[model samples]
Target: MSTPKMFNHKTQLILVALATVLITVFTLHANGYLRHSSEQDALYISEFSLIASVPGAQGLVSTKPADFIARCDGGYLVMDAAEKVSKNLTGVLVDQKNRLISCR
Candidate 1:
């Protein structure tokens, strides 16, 4: 007796086509040819500490003048002042072209 064929010619062709498509996709991904969303620039800050005294100033203080200077220089600064005052103190200094000038 002869052995029966497990898959016919048409079924084998279909499987070959599907495998080809999968292989193409895998190859593209391996070669970094797949499209992806652009990533945003990341900002880095240095470590430093400063103290400031404001005369005739009332209410609260957000960030120290030194910390403000650091922030302007592309460095991150944290102030121990109240949140409200800190929010007010937070401001970005930009150039005429609207570009950040506080980069060290």
Candidate 2:
């Protein structure tokens, strides 16, 4: 009777390395750390403006609003001249902007 050969040392090492790599990839993908830069679904843009606070504001308030404008990783498109992006709005800022501008 011939005895069956178990996984040799080299085979065992290779299997362990492969498992480690696969597990690492799976974990990164699951946690959203392995996303591609071209994925537009991850892009988010919001409009923020400074509002002057009242003298008698209850919470922490400042009299002078900052003049700095926040810039993100995209080109500028003036809302007035910019065409309608599409009927299918899928993001929070996009939907809110549409609703606010739409005369309903």
Candidate 3:
């Protein structure tokens, strides 16, 4: 009896291409290259860690102070290594600019 072919050559090629794409994507995502680093000049404020509460603005901590350029309803806020955010005291990241810039 002849064995039945599970998939045609074209189907196999398409499946292999899809698998290759998936693997590449997963590998890229696994590596940190897929994400924007906080060291970059334009950083998302959500990456900041809330350490203390201060008067006027809430305290936030970041690895690199110079990269703390985040935009809110008011404008872009520049923070030192130790800084505070004037608005959205509860949210983790920038209010409207929560979408992060993909590194790759």
Q: In candidate 1, which residue ranges exceed 4 Å CA deviation?
A: 38-104
Worst 10 residues of 3 by lDDT: 86-95
lDDT string, candidate 2, 46-103, tens digits: 4544456768765555787433222322332223211244333243223434543222
- lDDT by residue (tens digit), candidate 3, 1-104: 99999999999999999999999988998985587545444533444444566678865555665433433433334333324543323222433465432221
Query: TM-score: which candidate is best?
Result: 3
Q: Count the backbone clashes (under 3 Å) in each candidate.
A: 1, 0, 1
**Candidate 2: clashing pairs of residues:** none
lDDT of 1 at 3: 100
Question: Which pairs of residues clash in candidate 3, taking residues 3 or more apart in a chain or in different chains?
Answer: 46-93
Overall lDDT per candidate, in order of appearance:
0.54, 0.53, 0.54
- List the lowest-lDDT window of 10 residues for candidate 1: 38-47
> What is the TM-score of each predicted model, taking all chains together?
0.36, 0.35, 0.38
